[model samples]
Target: MSTQSVPVLAANDAASYLDLGITLALNNWPALTLAVQSNWGGPTSDDKRAWLCGAISEMLTERPETDAEDLEDVLIQVMNDEFDVVIDDESAAIVAVEIMEMKQHTDRGNFTEIQAMWEAYQLKSQQKSASAAMFKKVDAKDEDQETDDESDEEGEDVEMGDAPALVRAPREKAEPEIDDDGFTMVKKKR
Candidate 1:
């Protein structure tokens, strides 16, 4: 006997899209913010548009049945009804395409793959942040080496170390690295 293949989303899934999208947005806020900041190399307006679109796209993908048009529809609804921000269909469509590209990177029903991808993304982002901090420390050391003759005298004025220009809020826990084969390895405390 042969069986017909059905789409992954059911009627319940359709009903859950909005709520699920909201949950996904809230839960992934940090990652989403990083994505928006890192991906934008454009003007403020364009970057906001792209960021909103990408967020909507990411939200819809969680429901399994949404597509590019649905992405635009959600964005339009949010902008007009929810936020009172006006946007035309053409602009929405452009934003939708940008986000849909992210979804198309993964196959359907392979959520583990998507999770691993995110783990890798988060891991690399943290690494970049660490290296940037290291470079800043080195730069600070370099700046300290310009000695002055008068400053060396006992009666001369002495200045304490300057406060860092870039302040980093401490992270609670480090993200585990995902292996090349898509497995996240956590370090267990012994």
Candidate 2:
């Protein structure tokens, strides 16, 4: 009979996995994704998101007894500080709860949730890339059509009618009166 022993996860390894789970969870977060995609945290929005993941992981690891409420507060504060966003829709709370669950699961060496999140993120990225490609193709076609139209227009002489001459009423020049405060004062025209 052959006996096989399951590999045990070490403390450091578990912490690494927890960090990975936190990163995956943050990446899949719609609010953070949108903020990064839209450059909400300036040009380095992506970097900000990465920093946020690190911060969350560090907080969880350092404070093992941290609850979801604490996590939610961190999320809200970071969003406001880094992305200049105010999250009042309770999405931060939801993300915090998810992260807490991920932390618990990862601590126990169960990475099923993380794996599923990774797969979903990959699928979403692929779909976004496909959509961008399609948009580019359509845009390229539009540019080609515009170029053809411009070429056609270049082959013909365009007749532009004479524009109407602008007419203006002549105004009488008025001398400005100076006040004691060295300010120019003007009387209303009668």
Query: RMSD, each candidate, Å?
Result: 26.0, 8.3
Question: In model 1, which regions exceed 4 Å deviation?
Answer: 1-66, 73-108, 147-190
TM-score of each: 0.34, 0.73
Candidate 2 lDDT, tens digit per residue, 9-96?
A: 3545767667767777787678888998899999999888888888888888789899999999999999999999999999999999
Instruction: Give lDDT for model 1.
Output: 0.51
Q: Global CA lDDT of candidate 2, please?
A: 0.82
* Clashing residue pairs for model 2: none
Worst 10 residues of 2 by lDDT: 1-10
Best by TM-score: 2
Cα lDDT tens digits, model 1, 96-171, are 5544544454333233433444456568768989999999999887666544443566496668788879979986
Clashing pairs in 1: none
Ten contiguous residues minimizing lDDT sum, candidate 1: 1-10
lDDT of every model, 2 decimals: 0.51, 0.82
